[model samples]
Each structure stands twice: as C-alpha cells, then as structure tokens.
Target: MYVAVKGGERAIENAHAWLAEERRGDKGVAELSVAQIREQLSLAVNRVMAEGSLYDPDLAALAIKQARGDLIEAIFLVRAYRTTLPRLGASKPVETGEMACDRRISATFKDVPGGQLLGPTFDYTHRLLDFALDAEGEIPEAQSGEPQAAPVPHITGFLNRDGMIEQEPQGDATPPDLTREPMEFPANRALRLQNLTRGDEGFVLGLAYSTQRGYARNHAFVGELRVGTVPVEMEIPELGFAIEIGELRLTECETVNQFKGSKTEPPQFTRGYGLTFGMTERKAISMALVDRALRWRELGEDDLGAAAQDEEFVLAHSDNIQATGFLEHIKLPHYVDFQSELELVRRLRREAQATRQDQQEAAE
Candidate 1:
C-alpha cells in the first residue's frame, strides 16, 4: 500500500502548544488576572458583550484576556462562547418603561416633567492620561459608592405625558433573530434593530457619520439615553403568566430625527432606536442614526441609497467577528493561486516580446 503524509493530528497538537505559548507571551511576567481584565478593561468587556449579544461581564472579560487585548478577537471569543450556551426558552420582551435606570439624560427639552439626570458618564473627564496607573499602590480616595443602590427612573416618561413621541406598540408576538435567519429584503424593524445592536461598532459609527456629511442627512437629537438593568421575564403558556427570568445591564438611546409635515400627515417626531449592552452612549447614538437611516424606505422617504440606508450592505458586514475573520484570513497561504497568476503573466509577456520582434524584423 502506498503511504501518504499523515501527522495531521500531531501537527494540530503542536500548533496548539505553540499558540498557547504565544498567548502567554513572557514566562516570568505575572499573567493578567480575569479580575484585572474585568475591572481595568471594562470598556473592552462592554464592547464584547454589546457585539456578542451576551451580557455576562465575567465571560466577556475572560474572552478579552484570551484574545490578548485584540477587541475584535475578544468579541469573536465571546460570540463563539455565547453560541455554545444552552437555550433556556425565550424571555418576555423587555419593558423599557419599567427599566431601573442608573443613568438617564435627555437633550431634547430644557425642563421636562422628570428632571434630566446626567448619570455616570465620562463626558466631563479631562483628556490627560493618569500616571498613577503605573504604580502598584491603589489610590487613597477610591470611594466605593453604596453597593446597595436604588433604581433610577427613566427620562422618556416625561415626554410621554405630552405625547411628543408616538407610543410604541406592545406585542407578545415573538421577534425573529437575525443570526438564525438569512437576511431577506424588506426586513422588519425588529430584525433590523437586532442586526444593528450586534453590528460592528466602527462600521456603524462610520455610517452614522456619513449622514452628517450630507448623504441622507438626518437631523437628529438625542431624545433620551439611559443605562441600567431591566428585568427579563418569560411568559409560560403552562403558567398562563410571565415570570422574571433574569436582568441585563443595557444602554438604550432614542434619537428624535427631523421630519416634515406632509399633506396628509401631522407633524410627529420620528424615532431612532438603539439598545446595546452596558454603558455605551457613543455606540448607542451611532446605532440610533443607522437604525433611522435603515427605516427611510418604510417611512416613505426617498431612497437616497446612502451606505447607512442600504440594509443588505449594513446588515451583511456589520459583525466585527465575521468581517475580521474574512479580512485577516487573506493573510494565510495563497501560494498556489499566486503561482498560477505569476506563470500566466510571464507567458503573456514572453509572447508579446516575440510578437514585437517579428514586427521589427518584417519592417527591417
């Protein structure tokens, strides 16, 4: 029997060993603890949870460490880990009106029924880097605010009093998951919002930025933004009622975009929705704009064909894990294809050279 090259199993094992070594880096250095990652790299963890569609900060922190601080890679890690988790039935759709907010703010009105609360935000922080982090000793003034906290109220309830915005329709009808279904044209609001929440932060930000640059320019204002935990409940047919399943920390942004009073329509404010994991205002704001842009067709607005307005383009390449994988994979071996192209060009040049020589000789 003719023998063939084997050791595929051994090669994988050796490769894994090398990868583990590379992941560890310097041998003598104390490894980065998961606690350190969770506390210090919280923003990274927030992003992983936001894009991975999972709210477990501990798991997200671990993924960040495993990815060696590559945030996109960290997101991929979280997504892979998230997918393996067992399904525990569907939770009842979150009631945002009932959310227990930690932070809430509004930019739309000066003084509403509920006073604007500028919750925990980095907006007022100085731009200088702190040198204190270089030292091991902790800051003496680290005041841990009461671990036992009260739930803050939502800011949008004030606007609802005057009916400034349209009241959202409540439905027990199950929402479709964009991940499970292949994207079809004319996506419903639920499906579109689902994709946008898990979409790549950078790509979404760019599309949102483009709107300000004039392509389907949507004049938008932050109607409200809130961050906190909301109870996720489940309605059991057997139980005949809903029960609380768990809670999730989320940042929700609703932008009030410009709309004209049409001949048949009344002057009503349009909504741009963004709901993401953790305290991520910028991402939430960007998401809202992109969300609004995607709804142009449904809103009876002209098809400007803007990048943000293109559902197929935006939804298809929105996930960082998918984009990064496809983009980075191109760096791997493509030698065979390169060799064939190289030979084809070389043969074409040689033929051209002979043809030129023949023409010159005939003229002589």
Candidate 2:
C-alpha cells in the first residue's frame, strides 16, 4: 500500500511558484513565443509529436515553453494531455506513394526516376558554426525550384517487380492499438512498428548502432529515404467516399537487408521500414535498423540473443516517460522503506558483533 505524505503541500506549492519564476528568466530579455518555437525549433516539436503520439505542433510548442525547454518533460505534458482527448474516427492508411516529396534519395541506386533532390540537408555543409546568426541579420531568401509534376516512385517498388525482395503481407483487418490495449508478448509486426515509431529516439538509435557493430547484424542498405507531406483522409459514414482531413510532414526510410532464404523460400532481399512524423530522418533510419533486427524470428532466422532482438526488453524500456517516471520516483520520500532497510541492516550488524564477542570470550 502506498502511503501519502501529508505535510508538504504548502512547500510543493511554493516550489511550483518558484519554478514558474525561473522559467520566465530575465525580465530584460524578450519572452519566447510559442510561434517561434513551432517555426524555428521545429525538429524538437517533431520529436515531441512523434514520441508523444500527438501531431499538434502548437500544443507541443506550448508544452516546450511550459517545460522550460526540457523536451522529455514537454513530451510528458503532451502525452498526458493526449490521454484526455476523445477518440475520433480512425483515418485510412496513408498512401506514401502519393506523397509530394521535398527530399528523396536512394543510396542503392545511382539515379532514381525522380532525380535525387538534396532538399535542406546538412550532409555536405562544413561543421563550423556561423557567427553571422549570433547578431540580428536579415537572411537571404533560399533559391526556389519548380515542383515535380510526377509522383516520386518508391525505390523498393522497382526491386520488388524483379522478384528480388520479399513481399510485404497484405491485410484489411485493423491492427491492435497499443495505446488502448495492454501490450502482450509475441507482438505482431504492426504492433512492433507502432511501438518503435513512438519509442525513445536515443534508445532506438543505440540499438540500431549495436546492429551495425555486429550485434545480430543484418547488412542493411538504405534502399530509399524520403521526406514529404502526405494527405490524411477519413471516411464519413454519411458520405461513402473518404475525404482529405489534413496533411502531415513525414520521413520514411526503407532498408533492404540480405536474406539467404529458408527451405521453403528462394534467396531474396528482405525489407525493414520506418516512418516518423516530420523530417526525423535520423530517427526513421535508426528505427528501420532496429525494426529489421527485431524481425529475426519472423524471418526464420536464428535467435542471436542480441538486446535488439529481445522484443520484450526493447518495448518494455523504450518509453522515456515510463523510464523517467520510475527513475525520478526514487527521489521522492521513501522514508518508510529506507528506515525498514536501515533497521534490518543495523540488527544484522549488532547480532554479528555480539556473536563474534561471545566466540572470542569462549575461546579465551
């Protein structure tokens, strides 16, 4: 049974008020608006949205402001707020093939149908920080290009046509919602993907790195990586057809892995997929590597006992909110528990000292 600490309510309230003052910082300095955070610190907002499992950038920015730039705390706030929202109708599966891509590239191919559009990337830039941005200056407008009239084809589609890659399974049945239902062991690919997409970015990245360092290595190649806006559609019961609701900026990464076929199948390439909110290419790529690693059993491959391959271990600890909550709880008043432990240790030490003295006296 959990006992409530009764005397610290006033202290807690004062602490919160002090925290609000600290959050505001110097009065001389300009206060940060939510718009600035939403526009300028977009990547942080994206990470919060992805991990929090909520797509509202405005709310994310507000949370960021309230949390005093503590992203994990912001994510915690967003997630807590998300739970109170009423569930609306589910949208139809997003057609990524119809995505209006801003950036699309394939490491495997020299040139794709839609030529590699570099799109705002830091790939080739010098690592040195620009001091010009430290002072107020009007930034020059970036060069614009004509929008591509043709839809960018997925790189994997070409490989699949030649029967080189393993085919993705098709199902119309609605997948289990991990948010609503308790996660069970032996989770299907859909459930696993849901977990990975919303999982802690650092944890996922580390696991992905481990795979590259030969922990259940699945020689993954970036078949394609694309960042774009896709239309979200929902079907109305009154209207027979689905209507476009909104657009979401998404980053998708598809990795082709070498798969020497089993007895029933032919030697073919397998695929690992990752899709995340906004331009989170690093997270998407990392998620793909980890996703592929977790597919060892499904692919009829040997269980290599890698941490990434352990689904229960990965899913259980991947949530930052859950992890931080458990970790931070130790700082709270555990006086009763600690006191019991202290008494036990003291009693054991006293008995041991008494027994030792008696033994020494008897020997003498």
Candidate 3:
C-alpha cells in the first residue's frame, strides 16, 4: 500500500526555500551583515580560521554569517573553500621566541624574564552575568606598562641546562600531512599533533581531564602558556632566501611532566607541546596533556589502555565535522534498515511465543 515518493529535485527546491526563510527570521529586525560579523565578532572569526586550518579572517566571517553563527558549520564552509585554493608555497617554520607577546604566563616559576604579562585574560573574573551587557556598554581602558625589551626565555630551558630533562632529538625528515592523505594507525607525534590541533575542543578537553584523573596520570606543570603574534616566512627557490610573508596570532603551550627512571637512564622531566591558532590557552593546555599521554609508548612507559593513550581513538573521534556528519545523518531516511529490524523483532517474538506454548502444553 505504500508508494515511494519521487520528484526529489522539486522537494529539495521547496525545502531550500523554507530553510532560507528560516535562516532570516523576523523581517522587522535588521539583518546582520558579513562585515558586522567580521569586525564585531572577531573571536568567532579567529576560532573558525583556527579550526578550518585557514587564515582568511574575511572568509571565515562570511562563512559565520552564512551559517548563522554556527561555528562548526562555519568551519566546514571555510575548510571546503580552502580545498579549492591553489597551494603556492610552504611557509618556513615560525619562531615563537620572536613572538610579540600579548599574553604570557608561567605556572612553574614565580618570576620570569617577561614578568608574566597577563595581557587580557578572564582568569580571575567572576562568572556572574552583568545586566549592563543587555544594553550597549563600553569597556574601560586598560593601563599599560613599559614594553619588555628582551624575549622571554623558555621555562623548559632551565631544566634542560642541568640535564634534568630528556633531550629532544633533532630530525630533518618532513612529517606526513593528515589533510593531503588518508590517516593510518600507529601515527607519529607530528601526525598526532596535527589531528589534535584540528580536533574538537571539547573532546580534547575531556580526554585531557581523564588523564589528570588517574587514567594515564602524568603530573603536569604548565611550563609556559603564551599567546602572541608571530611573523610567518616562506623560502623562495628563485630568490634563494626566505622572506617574511605575514604575521599570525598563535597560542603555544609547553607542559613539563613527571618522568620515570629506567634501567638504562636516570629520571628526567619530559614535555608535552601544544600550539593553536588564536588566544586559546585551555585548549592548548589540554592538548599538551593529551600529547604527553599519547607519548607513553615512545617514553617507554606502560600503556594504561586509556582513551587519551590510544592514538587511533583520539585521532578518529577528534574531528568535529566527521563526528557531526555521522551523528546528524541519523535524521535522514532509514526506511529499509528500520523495516528489516522490525521484521526481525516480529519473527523472534513469534518463535518465543510458540516455544512458550509448547512448554505450557508439556507441563499440563
């Protein structure tokens, strides 16, 4: 009695029209412009650019406007657009030491060279909502001090000087790109880092939390958490030199964790590294924790079989777009699958009833 619906093209057109209307609700209200989103919602733009693995603030803002402020959807739009662009040249590795810092802090040392410039953080802020925000309000001007003359020294270097930390081996081999090719298991530290940078912030945070709570426990201390702008450079073969391309805002974190002594070596502090696109300290810190947890095998520590310790599990489930797609797809038509399941349940029920009837007769 059921007739399958055809005319998918017409149905799609109608649905699109409805969606468009829904996207721009309340005609009386002023419509938001892409420029407005770009200028006013700079943080959102930063997040989209970071997660999308692209640096175009204008395009990210446009995507945000088109997506109605849905960040993940905006990231998807930016990522899709990024694939269409031509790859001209690869940039030179950025130097964080040369970073013009806006925000920098250290948890391990009481004092540092830069003197812990807490530029613009909400660390000490209360969570209470201000009613003044409902109406347009102006922020007070922040007091500025004398500019720091010297670049802040890395905290880990202090430990490294005394041979209290494991020496990081220098490698010239270029790491594999997760975006250009299919992801394979038993990925190296570089590949794992790439996955984590593009991973869902919440998922990484939760996994990092688990590690702190005795699952692959590593006593971590924030070596340095810095947010600043660093200049990007690219090497041109024709020019025979590297030239400055542009500057990018970045958050870099280095965590010092407890190390265990082995038969071959004395105990030394190990490190976890994290880098992200913008002023995202929590994500950076979480990333460092997860990074260290993933290094159990390389560091010769016992595998606790924790979620963070499993490279495949972390890398596979970290992508927000893939997770969202798989989760949201359930809303789509699954008539055939549901029908099969229904038939199976009915058949099993019939058999069970028949067996029960036979048992009752035998007892009687």
Candidate 4:
C-alpha cells in the first residue's frame, strides 16, 4: 500500500503557486522592480554570479528578483539557464598582468611600485544602521578620482624583481569544465579551483578560518586581492583566430603560504591561487586559503586531517543547492520504510510476549 504513493507533481505545482503568492505578499504593496533589485541588492546579485559562473549582471539581477531575493535560488536559476546555452567556444586566459583593474591591493610590500588603490570597499565603514535608508533616500555620489589608462601592471610582476617567489609557467593546458565532467580523485589545479569557485561562500570562509585555527596550519598572508573586468577571448573557427567574446568582473586572490621547502622543492615562496566570477573578494580570499590547505601533498607538507585538507569532505558538502536538496528531500514520502520498521517492531514485541507467557507457564 505504501508503494502506491503518488501526487508529487501536484504537490510541486501547488507549492510553486503558494511560493509565488508568498513572494508577492498580499498584492497591496508596491512590487520590487527588477532594476531596483539589480541596483540596490547588487551584492546579492554578485554572489549569484560568483557561484553560478555566469557573468551577466542584468540576468543575475533578474534571477534575484524572480527568486524574491533568495540568493541561492537565484544561483540555481542562473545555473539552470546556463545549462541550456549553446557552447560558443573556449577563451584564451585573460592575462592578469594585463588586467584593467578597478581595485588592487597587496599586503606583502608597504611600498610597491604600482601603489595600492583602496577602490570600492566597505572595509572601514562603521556597521551602524542608517535610518535614512529606511526613509528611501537617494545614495550619495561617489567621490571623484582621476582614472588612469588601461593595462595596469600586476603586483606579482614586481615580486619577480626580488626573485623571492617561484615563477608560474604559462602553459596551453586545457582546463576541464566541472559541470560537464564527473569529478575524479586527485583533481588537477584547474578542477580544484573550479569546484571552489562554485562552492558555498560560508563553507569556504569557515574552512579558511580553520586553517588559521591550526588545522593543517599554513601560515598564509593575502599577497594580493584584485577586482575588475577582464576580457574573454575565444577562437572563432570561421574567423580562424581568437576574438574578444565579452568581459566579466572577477575577484582574484593570490596567497603567499609558508612552506618549509622539502628536499624536492627548494626553500622559496609557494602560491595559493583563487579566481572567482564577479566582485566577491571575501569568497575569493577564502578560496585561496582553502586551496593552499588542499595542496599539502604537492607542497610536501604532512596532512593534519584538517577539513580543508580533505578534498572529498570539502567538495562533497560545499554546494548549497546539492546540500539543501538532499537535506530537504527527507520530507518526501518514506511510508514504505516506516511500515517495514513498524512490522519489525510489532514482530519483536509479539515474540517477547510469547516468551514471557511460556516462562510464566513454566513457573506456574
């Protein structure tokens, strides 16, 4: 009888309608326009873009609005939509050395050649509630600063001067797309970074924080954090050459982690790299730290059984959608299992009663 369970489709449809009604909330208040959500709730949209691996701000904004500002739902929407998109081609890497940066900061050197630009950040602002925002006032204009020409020099290039850092070789190695391919063990750098990019922000942050707390302790310093738009170049078969397909806002974090330098690897600085979609600096920085922790084997460091050091643990539980889906799915019908357990309990009780009655008879 329990096997005959049905009506999942009906339940799903009703739930969707109820959700829509709930999102609207009485239909008397003014509806939140997509533009308003896009402009005002931009940080939420940035998160969606970062996790979804899509670069279109307008689409992300629309998804956020559709999701009623539920950022994870917005990410799901974007991810679903992207799945149907036709594959145009792959792009040549946007050279970080040639990135036209809006904000760039390096923690290593106090007086680097290209000076630190504290661009748009909420770092120093007090966390006090602004009652003026509740009154629906317009935001103030940004303080004007003189803009420089394109093609900003990278901080890493400056580090090349002292030769303190190990040089990363430029290669034509094709990066694997995690969405299309099943993730295998001993994942390459490209795959690991891809997984981290779409990983849950909070999960990555906590894991990164754990490293500071002595789990696979890697003495890490944020070498640089940069945010800006980068050109995506793709090869056109018809055109027979690569062309700029479009641009995307990105956050890149390079962490300088302490490595004791094994017999194989010489005593020099090792790198922990993170690159994520959009201007998600916190997530990007966390990604770098966690990435460094995962590289214990390659760096010749002993694995201290840290959560971040466990690739299986991190990748398996890092996705909010997958985690929530599996978690919430327990609410689905399990009457069969319940009934089976019920029968087992009843039989056990009956056997115990019979045994008790026999023992009573024997005693009598």
Candidates' C-alpha lDDT: 0.81, 0.93, 0.87, 0.84
Residues 5-54 of candidate 3: C-alpha lDDT, one tens digit per residue: 45579889999998788889899988888888878888788878878888
Maximum-lDDT candidate: 2
Distance from true location, Cα of 336 in model 2, Å: 1.2
Q: Residue 224 lDDT in model 1?
A: 84
User: Model 3, which residues run further than 4 Å from truth?
Assistant: 1-8, 263-265, 350-364
What's the lDDT for residue 196 in model 3?
Answer: 90
lDDT of 1 by residue, 196-265 (tens): 8988888899999999799898898898888878999987778899888789888899888777744444
**Tens digits of per-residue lDDT for model 4, 236-336:** 99999988988877889998876768856877777888888878999999999999889888867787888999998988788887887788767878889
Q: Which residue pairs of candidate 2 clash?
A: none
Clash counts per candidate, in order, are 0, 0, 0, 0
Order candidates by TM-score, high to low.
2, 4, 3, 1
Q: On TM-score, who's better, 1 or 2?
A: 2
Candidate 1 TM-score, true structure as reference: 0.86
By TM-score, the better pick of 1 and 3 is 3
**TM-score of every candidate relative to the true structure:** 0.86, 0.97, 0.91, 0.91
**Candidate 1: lDDT over CA atoms?**
0.81
Candidate 2 — worst ten consecutive residues by lDDT sum?
1-10
